[model samples]
Target chain A: MVSFTAGDAVARRPAKPGRLSRFFFAGNGAGYMFLAPWLIGFLGLTLGPALASLYLSFTDYDLLQSPRFVGMDNYVRMATGDAKFAAAMKVTFIYVILSVPLKLIFALALAMAFNRGIKGLPFYRAVFYLPSLLGGSVAIAVLWRQLFAADGLVNSVLSVFGIDGPSWISNPNYSLYTLVVLSVWQFGSPMIIFLAGLRQIPQDMYEAANMDGASKARQFFRITLPLLTPVIFFNFVIQTIDAFKAFTPSFIISAGTGGPINSTLFYTLYLYQEAFGFFRMGYASALAWVLVLIIAVFTAFSFLTARYWVHYDE
Target chain B: MNDAAHAAPPGDTPERPILHSVLIHSALIGVSFLMLYPLLWMVSGSVRPADDMFGGQTSLIPSQVTLQAYKTGWFGLQVSFGTFFLNSLAISVLATIGNVMAASVTAFAFSRLEFFGKSFWFALMLGTLMLPYHVTLIPQYVLFLKMDWVNTWLPLVVPKYFAVDAFFIFLMVQFFRGLPRELDEAAMMDGCSAWRIYWKIVLPLSLPVLATAAIFSFIWTWEDFFGPLIYLGDIHSYTVQIGLRSLIDSSGTSDWGALFAMSVLSLIPIFLIFLFFQRLLIEGIATTGMKR
Candidate 1:
């Protein structure tokens, strides 16, 4: 069947020189006509700006002045001199590490629970997904700030327990964790994805496992976990990338300062501060390149390590 | 298949005991309530009298409901919140239209047409999906600034018209690929132009994907904070997010009622979208494996 289809496709290809030329011309013309907008955007917006930013990273370009080439000074300064850079990196890494795994775990557990033939699955799914839809909005960040305030609902709840709670948003030691909680609160999307992934696993697998006297836990480990690895890997990479780019909650919560001693200064927030707040465009460009590199390395690492864990049916 | 074969036994029958079902329901209910607590608190606080907003009141029910906060929050700032809403609506609508139009055509080209460097361009397009926006942030800002587009919606809306959002294109491409080739082949036999085929045939059949892209684009653009915060300097031009942020800066927790009121108001459009188009939204996410 495959060879037949291959032969059919080859036969359909334009064979005569004149016909082939006409095919090429007409195809290219129509294709380019349809692709004009994307082509323009690709060249003018994406590729052009990317290359310009790369060049800008090595120069001292404030908004007013033309770029003055400064070689690797910005990169060198980031490596050796910038305290806030180091602090931002620490806070962002902590956020990504704490939030992604916790969110995925919560998502997977809830997904498994929902997969157990629960009633009103759609209702529960919608209720769970509400947070993720609204979570990235500025209002949610504002709500988060108030929720963790000293006299806010959290403290009020803690008071009922006869325990005093420090101001989670204001206290430097706890501020980043508040943001982490905020990220984990929006685990709804991943949970939904996991639910979809769960549905794809054949019921026959479980039926077979049950007949073999495999315990529920053993069946999960032996069947579901291995099957769900691809989805897990996908969620891991996407969530990590997203967590690294997290800015709005930290921005609104920190009031654009990333303050209380920069405890919640996300890496993107720091990049924004450098680019817009201080107009240190060159340094900010350098920071942006570093971020791109970091994401690239992480993505490449994920793909490389995926072979060992991410099971696929061939 | 026979009815008996079709009606297979439920897996893990022992686990489906009444008590187990009860436990699962109760656990989900408890977690759901905890998840929604903050939002409920915000809603309750928004209605409570300004004086009653503080002093650690954690109740979901207000002592007395008043429209005072809504009244104050609407006209609170130098420019009323109505203006911000209008601004956000205009931007989101224009951006969504532009994104759907541009992405559809681009996806059609990739899915239905053969051209030189097709695979290479498709690969590049996908590469952009994983490229961090930060890499282009500074240079784009510079380009827009040089064009005297600062404090305007041009920077936000124009690139979308150029199909800068590769995710939408990728989504449409996936959908377009699933469309039967026989339809296009039949159309071509009738002497239909590629444009006509895309416009008259393919697009009508692609309402689901197109609607998915439009809904997501509008919601994401409306929720976007960083773009408006950077580009828009004038309060009159503030998006809903910027206006909400400014309200916080101005109020500084002194007027929690008004802040919460405005916050609630900011979320209403998104809430309405979720309430209405939920099925499409869920199907979109499930098929694409994407989150907005």
Candidate 2:
């Protein structure tokens, strides 16, 4: 890529870029000038809040009262006593495991179909991606609620074959699955990413496999799967992180409560309830730290395991 | 669009045996139906009378299409939906502009300038991508509350001005890094300052990514519920997302058709944006994912 350099013809500036020169006239000053916004954000909005949240995790600071130091009480409660936290964790892990894999499978399948060289390829891509574009909106979440009601479109569709459908948002067992379906439905981003990955695989590899008398399935496993691993890993890490952060649908569909016996209580929703609803800022900060830890552990695990499976030809 | 992307590779004939072609098309068409069905139902629901919205009626077109829902939902509960739309548009447009501008300058610095601790800063920037927003929510809220910026759009919009959305900045950095180094050198030889090189050379060439940033920031801000939800209290300050939420949560006398109508109306702007910039968004997302 891109790099700016003084041309060789203008070769008089070989002097050292010391403190005074760096501050006054060197590229560093200009560079930092350009980075002012992000720099300020890093120090103030991001780094400050992040560190504060860590400190806040040990205190009982509701908005009304000044934070009183509680010394690991929040952690103790979370680890040892909070049944709701456990339930929320269970619900979220299940949602993430179920949704991420299914969404990726759908994305990969369609991307393969698109790569088969369909006409109006962009149009199809846009149509499929439409859900994802609107996926996080309250309108879509509300629409989801209506679509899965006992009297709603899903049951209506099911009734054609003379079968009944449950009130997906009402039943505790099924409410979480409805959110999972919503997650799966918004597979368009991963689909496009998969398409890009599919494009990067050299056609010659498939041709070479075919020459070796490899069947399509064999070629897929040997050539496609291995080559696609890096992209798969990227999607997995990004989507898993995203799945863990899912809020709008859970909040909107469940009407801001982790209702129907707390089945749809995503971790973020529970965190929200703790912080905003109950104004338990300390407890919520602890929950937030746990989330960061969970994401970091999973990301680290993915990178570790990636060496075994994710092949990068470069 | 890249020519290489569209230009099919040699011997990659898409037209194949009849059975295979039929099967593939059937699968694609079938799945496409699944993909489109929810929106179709939503649109249909929007047009139907309240009584006809649910309960075993799967028809995409009702027997008698009605505008009653539109008429009612447009006014909403007390405040008309138009005010919410304007509020959403104001927030979204301002945020998009801030994001695009902030990301450009920031990306320019990271990509071109030899700065101290650049790698550390870059890593820190990327680290924020996975730092759950919940960590930032309370302190920032507290900070804003102290500033008396709560009950205002500042809490939602101010961070964009600070390049707080690392995703867009990262995306732009990737795009900028992909550009040819020679162009910058040649421009620099003509005595173009780094700012000029950035403003004239880099900015012009980086339209695709900038546009991508604009579109995504717009869509996300428009759809954002949490920030506005947390910061703004009461309906008068509500963005469309919060407005829609209130409409949904309004007690027992819920009007399904009106709700559907309002929902459809809410989706229209995003739909139009997606239709126009569908290619850019797709490519942006792809590049962000695969290139990284």
Candidate 3:
């Protein structure tokens, strides 16, 4: 059993000045105590796996057998020998580059359109935002596959216009485009961010511009565009990271094949195949490390460049 | 124009402009149709008789509707979706409870308490936010497998207790930071323990943000398929998403109607939650974005 002193409650009072000097030490110790779980997860789970992968990048450790340290073997294989990895890289880059910019443009445009005083604005915003919430799920990816199939809804609609649609998810050449369309369709989250940014723009500026006979286009370019750049930069960094980490759609749509001759094999999907499918844990670990480095490099580069472009109100 | 602006607000009249109202309504209606089309198609496709599912044109309305698909889907497969919904609900609720309690407690410490390694630990927490789950998935799975947690809700629920989600913590911290420190100082002057202040003061005032977190967590967990798919291999343990996927994979003849019905049903909880918490969610999201 526990016993409490009469002054246990009184002990809650603010520490004395002499003792307060030790507050940082006391607080730091308590803070670390509070952070213990996350720190343990980081050091034990994240750090261990991360370092293992980096080391394994130099080895050939298929899951069943012991990993043999073959320095630079996997890197060499990737750099010079592996053609499919290169193909996967190309497909992923194209998807990211095309989808990211288009998504931003669409989201920003729609946000601007909806930012005007409109009735039932919430309903409209919710409608546009729904697709993004559903975007990354297996069900949505399955829905994408069904919608783009030869005898599916898209083709059925196309048939009315006397034009036949290609097998969207099946055709290697067209499959990537379908995925790009899928990415654009789920532009809701970015649109929400843009909407939030739009709301922050003071109405007085626009009114002043209107009084000065500034065209809507000119007003957008001079005021709205410059002011919204920070939000845009924020969205760009997040979307780019998300796009690079894309997995669910390709996994579900391809039925784990990544096929139609390996068209939709995303980086993370390929990493899964290596680790889980081929039992190449060591190589997969190496790939994982490479991905980390790539993400870090891209993120660092973005931050380095952000100084020139991103504007802060304060 | 200057005289009119001085006399009364511009665009203020005895009544709202009929033309503007019409234009707004029309635009909203048009966008609503676009937003709801795929979902509508999914519903219609799920209910239509097998022969009429792909009958001809992409009609928004179904030619023939039947509940036979739902009937067959429920009992046809060795697995049933009723059980799957139960699985999803149980996991979602447990995860939500764990997340709210653990996240709020930790957020309290980070926000209100003066402690050592506060900034360093907070930075570490934020750093975890940027680390993609893909990097951790294999190891996490391997860890679970070794612990014999596979095919159990343990894998799904345990992380919630540990405050694995930095986003929620960050959000709650921001919410708690907005609260006045005067409350804590006054409570201290009156000899109130930190825990008491957190319980009596912070928890009560933090309801709005907590509600926001709860709503998002429930929806996210409900819709989550990947974690359940990877961890729970047993058919009996399948969540709705996994159940639907398995149905599609196992059925000799695809039952589009039943799949669509289940999909519609699956979206219900999220929509209902949104309807109930719409204002809170809107304000929460708006404020969080603005604060950032």
Candidate 4:
């Protein structure tokens, strides 16, 4: 590390009496000073709040009343009695399952297309990436609502073909699908990562495959895909975590309702409702901890599974 | 200028080149439309009258254009577009500055310095990248709330000084690592301190990557709705996205034209930043990746 090297360098240089030692100490002091605000923030803001939330989760803290130690009552109630929580879980799981795969495919497909020595590459890259940059914001969520409402642009477009389209955002059963589509549309970030990975694949491999009379499709599947696995795995892990924690769109589109029938209610959205909306901070803390556990388990599972499929070159 | 341009095709049909060019252009054009359509529609809808904004009667050009929506949205602090823009700008600019300066120092330490636990510390930083931001949200929120800092910009900009975002650190580290060590070594031989070397020599050479980090942090923090939404309760402190969300009253009937107009305006700053810094980002990525 820089700190140790600088210390040694100071000790070795015998210039002024204790000047080098003083400089070394000064550097360390400066580094710590620079880190002070964040350290304070972490200890006071982050760590303290985390502990409070954990303690509160085991109590009956309704914001107004002094928290009574209820000892896992919130957990038991959520796990056993809360059907809405169950529905939210189901919706979020379905969303993660549906969105993650489709988003990966879309990103991968676009990345591959762009990788094929396209002209105006930067222009295309910027254009495609703009959506992801805008995706999770309230503005985009509102746009999604308008784009999917019965009298909205999508349905109206369908009307031109004499095919009536359903109200995608308003229909309880179909509402979640609108969110899924939104997820798929914001494929830019993963696509950029994929593009970077694709460039790392040796061009010589393709040349050799071509020499062996391999078709483009065969080369892509045999060479491009296998080499791209590590990046795919990375994207998968990040995107899955992101989709599970998705909140803004559902919150905005549903108008903080989590309905037409709680179909569009994501896990984070529900947790937020419990914490802020309903003032059930204790229950929300439990829900937050559950989410962390779920994500950890899923991430660990993927990392474990990566050995079978993810092809790390080195 | 280059040998590839003049190199003749080996045993290829004359028509192959022309056909390939055609195919590539056609595909590019098709893909371009797919990327541009939604944005084009959004822009056009902002100008179009409500009746002409939707339907089986969609046109590439609006039948009637109006500036009334823009006038109403921009000047009307009733919804507070001006305040929100300033809020987003302040948060994003401060966050970007913190990210650039702090990330550069941390990355310089990791890449160039040979201190104790260097690898361990580096790995620790990388490990933090794997931990989802969601895991830290509850704790971070509580921390700020306890300090009575929840409704302020402190929560948004302050933690960035700690190099909390390992991605930016990783990015800058890669850039710093790619720089020739001879510069620092030569400076050291001339009795230059490490801080002086970083400030004068390395930092100057790292403008490209720093620009990349700055632009990225600006765009990401600018568009971050969640942080502003949770931390800032007062309407005056709402960022553009949150402020836009507030426009939709409980009745569910929002002024569509005004919303879209504000959306278009909100996008301008990001778009301009992207246009300015994009070349630097592309060049930095290409050179840095190729270095090792």
Candidate 4 stretches greater than 4 Å from native: A1-52, A63-67, B1-24, B75-79, B114-121, B280-292
Docking class of 3: acceptable
> DockQ score for model 1, please?
0.79
**Per-model TM-score of chain B:** 0.94, 0.91, 0.89, 0.90
Residue-wise C-alpha lDDT for candidate 4, range A1-314, written one tens digit per residue? 89999988888776775786766675556454444443454455445565677787788766567778889899899889999999999999999999999989988988888896777788888877777766766767777888888777788778888889898888888999999999988887787778888998988898788778888799989999999998888788888888888888998889887898898888988988877788777788788878878988998999899999988877
* Candidate 3 structure quality by residue, lDDT tens digits, B1-292: 4335433545457344555567767866876786677767877877787778774448877777788777877764686788888999999999999788778878888898887557877887788777777666666666777798988999999888777777788889999999999999999789786678888999999998999888878878888877886788898898987887776677622566666666667777776876677767666655554211
Supply every candidate's count of residue pairs whose N, Cα or C atoms clash at under 3 angstroms: 0, 0, 5, 4
Better of 1 and 2 by DockQ: 1
Highest-lDDT candidate? 1
Error in Å for residue B81 of model 1 = 0.3
Question: How far out, in Å, is residue B251 in model 4?
Answer: 7.2
- Report lDDT (Cα) of residue A214, candidate 3: 85
Tens-digit lDDT track for model 2 on A166-247?
8888999899999999999999889999999999988888778766778878977888888898999999999999999999
Best by TM-score: 1
Best by DockQ: 1
lDDT of 3 at A148: 85
Model 4 lDDT tens row, B1-292: 2234323435556677667767877886787686667677778888887677654655668898988777766754464688889999999999999888888888877787665455766676676665546556665665577689988999999878766776778888888888998998899789887788889988999887888888878877887877887899888788988777777652254566777787788888877876777666545434432100
**Clashing residue pairs, candidate 2?**
none
> Model 1, residue A133: displacement in angstroms?
0.5
C-alpha lDDT (0 to 100) for residue A83 of candidate 3: 75
B1-292 in candidate 2: lDDT tens per residue?
Answer: 4334333444544454445667877877788888898888888888888777656888788878999999888886788888899999999999999999998999999998777778999999998877878888899989999999999999899999999989998999999999999999998789778899899999999998899899999999999899999998967889998888888777322677888889999999998998888888888888887211
Model 2, residue A6: C-alpha shift (Å): 32
Q: Report the candidate with higher DockQ, 1 versus 4.
A: 1
